[model samples]
Target: MPYLLTGAQGQAGRRLLSYVVSLPLPNTDAQLLAAVLAIRAARGGVGNVTGTDLSTLRLEDARAAAAALRGLGWQIDGVLFDGDPTAAVAVTIPDLARETGHPLPVGEKLRSRVSGWVARTLTAKPVKKLPPAARLAGLFLAAHGTCDSAGQIPADLPEACRAALPDLLAKGFLAELSQDRYRLDEAVRHLSGVRPPTGGQATRPGAVPSSWPQFNADAWARWKSEATPALRRHVEAVEHCALCALPVDRVAQAFMVAPRPMVIAKATMGAYGKWKGLHPDRGSLAAEFTVAFRAEHGHGPSYYQLTSGLGWGLDRSLGAYVVTRLVKNEWLVTTGAVPWTLRPGPAAQAQGIALPKARTEAPGDVPAAV
Candidate 1:
C-alpha cells in the first residue's frame, strides 16, 4: 500500500510527506512500501522515495492509479491533503479501506486524525429537509471551512458538492461573508474537529483567530437566536480505534510496514530478485524488437513467423505475451487483422522516428504513403 500526498508541490504537502516517510515501522511487512507517492498536475510529478518518477499525469489520473493499486490487492493508506479537503474526505482513505475490507495503514501520526474524521463523520447530522446532494454539501461545509479567501470553492471539490454550496450557506453552516463568499461558524468548525490556522500561524493556543471580515449582522443575529443550532447530531462515543476491530491478519497488514531486504530475500528468491537485472543502459528483448521493428519496417513485427524472425523459438502464446507487453507500454499499435498488423505506437513516435511503409503490413493492406 502507498500513501498519497496531494497538493504535493505545496509547502505543507511536501512537509507532511517528508515527515510521514521518515517514521519508522516494523520491518517484516511487504504490504507497505516505505515510499511516498506525491501528485500534482502543474508540474506533472508523481514519484516515490525509490526515485521512480512517472511524470506529468493529469489530476484525474490519480483515480486510475488508485484503481491499479487495488487490482494488485494493495490499498492506499491515506491521503495527506495540503489543499481543500472537502472532496478529499469524501474519498477518505480510511473510509475506502473500511468499505472494501482492505487494510488501511494506521501510523501513529495519522491515527488521531483518522479517528477524529471517523468520529465526526459517523456523528454528523444530515439536513433532513434538504435533498441528498444539498445535505452532503451542508456536511462538507460543517466539516471544512467555507470557501477560501477569494470566495472560490476549493478546486478539489466534486462538482455535485460545489452545486450544494448555496443552499448550505443559507442555513448558516456557512455564514455569508461577502459577495459569493462565506465563513464557517465556530460551532460547525468545532464539530468538524478542524481549526484553521490562526493569524496564518499553526493552530496553537493564544494565536489570534482569523476574523470574518464581512459577517452579516442579521445572519449572525439569526444564528445566535436559534434554539439548538439544530444542524448537528448531539452524539458522542468513546472513539475506540477502528483498526482494533479488524481480525489479526487484517490488522497486521494495516500499516504499510515494509520488510527488510534480507527478510524479503528469505521469503521468496524470485520476488526479491525481480529488480536485479533491470539495467538502465540496456533494453529488454521486447524493447529491442520494438526498436528494430520501428526502424526497419516502421511498425511492430507480426507473430506470423515468430520462431524464425524473433530467433527465440517463441510459440504463439509466448510471442503474443511479448507483443501484449509492447502494446501496453505503447510501443506498438494494432492497425487491423485478417493476418493481424501492428504499427509503431506513441512510444516509437516519441523517439523521433519518421515511420515508413512496412512490407510486413501485407502488400495489399499497405497504405499509399509510408
Candidate 2:
C-alpha cells in the first residue's frame, strides 16, 4: 500500500517523514517498498517520494492519478496518510470513489472538483451570513474532518479562531461541547460539502494515537494553588464590613447572592421618629443601618433591631460580635443606658451617610418601616 501526504510542506509532515525515515528497516523489508505520494510534481531529491503539483486535486484527480498509474502498468492504492495529530483521518480509497461516483476530469480544467465543492459550500445559504474569518475557520475545521458530528471544534484550534466559537454556535455554524471544544452541526457540514471519513471512525483529536496526556488533576491542583490566595485577599479587602469582622467565606456566603432590601410597611414608622435625627456618612453595612434607623426612629438601631435586619440567621452572640466590631471601629455607640439606644459615631458620619426624608404614607400598599 502507498501512503499519501496531504500537508507535505507543513511541520507535522516534516516530523512524520523524519520519523519514518529514522526507523531501521532491512533492505528486503516489504513494507519499506511501499510508495510515498506528494502533490507537488517533483521528487525533490527524495528517492521514495513522487508527486503532482495539483494543489486543488479532488476525487476525480485521484481517479486520473489511478488511471495514469494503470497506463504505466503500475498498481496504485488509494490509502492517504495525513500526519496532523488533530486531523488524522483514514479513508477507504475504493469506498471514497464509489461514494462520490463521478467521472474523472480531463485536461484544461484549472479548478479541481474539490474546489467546486468548497465554492458551493461557501455560497450556501446557511453559511452566507458568517463573517469571513469565522467562515474560513469553520470551513477549515469541517474539511479536515476533525470536528465531531455534534459540531464540537477540536481543542487544538488556534486561540484567535476559538473566540469565534460562541458566535458560530449561536448562528448554527458550530456547537460547543466544553471549554475550547466545538462541533459543526450536520446541516453546516452537509452544506459545506464536508464529509466524514469512510467507515466513520477517527482517532481522538489533540492526542497521540493509543496514548493520552497526563492526568487533569495535576493541572487543576496547580490552578487552585495559584488562585486561592489571590481570591482570598480580594474577598477580604472588598467585603470587610465595619460592623461584621467576619471571615471572608462567611461574608461571601451571606452576601454573594444576598436578597434585596426588605420591604417594610410605612405605617410602622411612628415609634422610631421620636428620637434625635442622625445621619450616617459611611458606606458600610453599619452606616446603612444607622441611616435607616435614624430615618425611621430618629436613632441608630438597637442590638435586636440590627439582628433582625441582618436576616442572616445569626444568633444574638454573633449579632453582639458584629456590634462589638462596629463599636471598636467607632462606627456606632450606645446613646442610652436603659434601652441601649444605638447612634452613629464620627466615623459613620464621616463616611457620608445622610438622613432621608420622613414619609407620611406608604407606597405599593405597604407601610415603609425600612
Candidate 3:
C-alpha cells in the first residue's frame, strides 16, 4: 500500500488521470505511459524521459508504446529502446504546448506534483509486479475511491482495466468490488481522489478549531481597510488563497500573533553543517523554487512545503536551521517573521533571480513584495 496522502496531495493526481482518460488513446501500455508523460509536459509541453523510466514500466513492447505516442503527433526524438539508459530524451506534445486550449493548464508545482503521483501510483506495492493493464486499473480505482464510501467506476475507465479488476481485488488494493462500484482498502485510502466532506467537524483529524476566540472578524476587516494597497493585496492573497482554503480564524490568528524568537538546537545545527556540505547549491535552488512557487501560488511556500516540494528530505529541526542559514546569508528573505513571506534576497537578486515585485521596488522597499 502506498502511504496515505492528504486531500491536497491527491488533487493533482486526480486531475492528471481525468485529463488523460478523456483523450482518444486506447487502453494499452502506451496510454499508461502517456498519462505519466502528459502531466510532466503539462507546464511547457516538453518533458524529459530516460530509458530507465521506460524500462521500469516493464512494458511488454517498449517500441510499440513509443510508436503509438508518435502516431498521435507527439515527438519522441529517438527510439526509447535504443537510447542510453541514463540520458534524458525530450518528448514534445503539441496540444499541451499551445498558449490557448492547453489540455492540461496547470502551474509548475502542480505539474511536478502530478507527475510524481503517477510514478508512485504505478509502482505502488500492490500493483508494481502486475501487468501494465492491471497497474493502470489500480490507478483508476485508487483515484476515484473515497475514504468513507464506495465509488462508481468512472465511465472513462479503459476496457483493458475492467478486465484487470480481479487482479486488484486479489492484491488487497480493493476492499469491496461490486458491479459498477468499488472501494479502496483502508491502507490505500490516502490516495483517494475525491475531496472529503467539509464544513462540519473539520475532516482532518486534530484540525484547529474553526472558531478562534482570539480572532475578531470585524477587527480584521478594519485592519485591512486601513492598510496600504500593497499590504492589503498581500494580506488578501494569504487569506483567500484558492489552493489553501484556510479558515478565516486561522488566517487572522497568524497575522495577529507576534512570532516567537526561534531557538535552534545544537543537534539541528550539527545536522545542517553536515547537510550543507552535501548540498552546496542549495541556496540557489531554494531561491529558484520560490520564484516559481510564488508565480503559481499568490504567496510564498511554507517551510515544510518548501523542503518537501524541493525533495530536500529534511526533518523539521534541520529544515529550520537550513532556512535560517539561507536568510542570514541573504539568499532568502522573510517579512518580519510573517509566515509564507519568503522570497529571493540580495544574493539571489545579484545572481539575476528575483520575484516580480522585487525587480520593480526600490531596494529599501523590498519588504513590500510580501
**Model 2: per-residue lDDT, tens digit, 1-370?**
1111111011122222222233332211111121122111111111122122111222223444444443433344333222332332221222112111111111111112233334444455555565544544454455433223443444444444456556667776665445745565655544322222323222211111222233254553354356334333333432332222233333333223333443333432332232112212111445545554343233344564454442323344444555655766777765323122455555655655434443444233211122
Q: Pick the candidate with the highest lDDT.
A: 3
lDDT, candidate 3, 109-140, per-residue tens: 54675676677778877888999899888888
lDDT (CA) for every model shown?
Answer: 0.33, 0.35, 0.73
Local lDDT at 217 for model 1:
46
Which candidate ranks first by TM-score, i.e. highest? 3
Which is better, 1 or 3, measured by lDDT?
3
Model 1, residue 224: C-alpha shift (Å): 47
Model 3 residue 362 CA deviation in Å: 51
How many pairs in model 3 have backbone atoms within 3 A of each other, for residues 3 or more apart or on separate chains, i.e. clashes? 0
The superposed Cα distance between candidate 2 and the true structure at residue 367, in angstroms, equals: 90
Residue 14, candidate 1: Cα error in Å is 14
* Candidate 1 segments whose C-alpha is farther than 4 A from its true place: 1-109, 118-131, 142-151, 177-180, 191-201, 205-370
- Alpha-carbon lDDT of model 1: 0.33
Q: How close to the true structure is residue 267 of candidate 2, measured as C-alpha lDDT? A: 33
Looking at candidate 2, the ten consecutive residues that score lowest on lDDT are 99-108
What's the lDDT for residue 216 in model 2? 51
